[model samples]
Target: MITPLKAVLVGCGSMSRAWTAAAKDIPYLELTGFVDVVEDAARQRAAEYGSPTAVVSADLENTLDRTRPDIVFDCTVPEAHMPVTLTALHYGCHVLGEKPMADSLENARRMVAAASEAGRLYAVIQNRRYDPNIRRLKAFLDSGEIGPITTVHSDFFIGAHFGGFRDRMEHVLLLDMAIHTFDAARLLTGADPVSVYCKEWNPPGSWYEHGASAVAVFEMTGGIVYTYRGSWCAEGLPTTWESEWRFIGRQGSARWPGDERMQAQVVTESGGFLSTVRDAIIPPLPPGAKTGGHAGIIREFVQCIQAGTQPETICSDNIKSLAMVFAAVESAETGLPVSVSV
Candidate 1:
């Protein structure tokens, strides 16, 4: 019989619903605790997940002590991640937490150091890397049909009017949301950010308190240039949340309209002023590939701990993605290009 790994979920916010739901489907996992600053939130999440008797508490350390969970699922907000992750690692438990890694690079580094000291796994849920289209796109890019990638571009425009903390926060787009896209850029290009120049402004008629719109230019490893133009105040004909992506290479280019289907075109001959073009086939996913998004990342976190391996989004690696976010924010603040580091 399989001995299930007991897991405690920290932070019972709206995002916690997805984590709890995914846990129920993993046979190797057993939900044993739920925690939030507000005990009622924990109780509500526990009952909703059919674990009414689970240890529901307002105190994370106390809950961890009581349950003795083998794993800690951190669904906490950015600022809370540092303490939650440190506490979990201090308990000798593996951790899987939500994206953006931490509120700042210093805190993220502290979390990484704590995990290393504990000798346990700590991975982030950069779930965007697990999408079907992205997997297929990655395969296609590596096939060399595009020759050498020269440039990448993405556009994100959506009027997100959440009248809460986000509307009141500074660097709203870069801090609260742009990290997802930055992380995706890393996954797709298999490159790290070298430096960045960014301009951020709260557009006229914007609903947010600060920095709702921005444009950034990034120099990636391999001399690839990535440009991002985004606005949370854009209302008409908004791009998909995944954002429309275009990757250009010497021989060809491919586009993903932030959707399942992708299209590509390559140069066939050089007779005309512009080289003759032919459609390039975007390949399909490799057989048995798993693109399970949130569930996929959660499963990876558990599987890696059991196998004594590191998951792809482990803190040491994911901090690069987070660095891009901070670098862009710094560039926006200083009005100068800043080196990207973690």
Candidate 2:
């Protein structure tokens, strides 16, 4: 039988629960250690996960040395991502980190360089891409049924009253939430950002200490234009977590109603003064593993590490998604369009 890859999990915060649960379902992965700034948190995670033999430590470096894991699962905050990833690389361990890559583009670049030097895989978990409905939408866009997508739009609205760090975070919407939609836009359109014009504001009756609403228009490669409107302070008529999306291509347009349902319209035939429009049948999605979200990403991360291949959210490729966030923020701050730096 093949030996399972040992893993050391860092950060015993809320997101760690999802990571630990996913690891349990992957037979090829063994959760060997749990690390957090607070030792009690790590201990609690180990106990909850039934990892009696798992090493629990407040010091990550010490835990890594003790466990000698094959990989490091980083569930830490964005600001700590770079340091955690670098430490893992130095220890000759692969890293699977939570999204947004890093707090800044410069740190993200450094992480990518370190991973390349270490010759180990470094992947970010963009779990939103693993949704079956998202997969179906991507497939439809790729099938040329959309015929070269030229425009895309997404709207996200939610009134979450989480009382924590996010309440006081700056650019809270762009940094914490919009990255999902930005990354999903790239996946669905297969395009990189060129430039973006953005506007950010805090609406009246908002609870966040900083910007909680924003609108951005991004120019992408192949002349594709993507627009985004999001608000974390919206109280009523909140959109689904996935966000509503509309994609317009030369031949047709597709819409995802922020849920599992999708619909498309295409022009069947056209003349000088007349045109015919019909519903474009969306194709069935391909078969995939039963697990998705964090679990799906975990499975792919392990498979890529074992196979010596790069996963979809490899740091190098994921940087573009991160760039979109920074670009939008920069535009909002400067009140001018800014070129996306990748």
Clashes of each: 0, 0
Flag clash pairs in model 1.
none
lDDT of 2 by residue, 1-342 (tens): 455799999989999999888888888788999999989989988988887899999999998899999999999988899999999999999999998799999999999999999999999999999888899878888999869999999999999898899999999999999999999999999999999999999999999999999999999999999999999999999899899999999988899976779999988898758568799888877776223889899998898878778899998999999999999999999999999997
TM-score against native, each model: 0.97, 0.97
Regions of model 1 farther than 4 Å from truth: 1-3
Candidate 2 segments exceeding 4 Å error: 1-3, 272-274, 289-291
Q: Positional deviation of 57 in candidate 1, in angstroms?
A: 0.8
Across 21-61, the per-residue lDDT of candidate 1 in tens digits comes to: 88999978888999999899999999988976699999999
Residue 255 alpha-carbon offset, candidate 2, angstroms? 0.9
What would the TM-score be for candidate 1 when compared with the true structure?
A: 0.97
Deviation in Å, model 2, residue 335 alpha carbon: 0.9
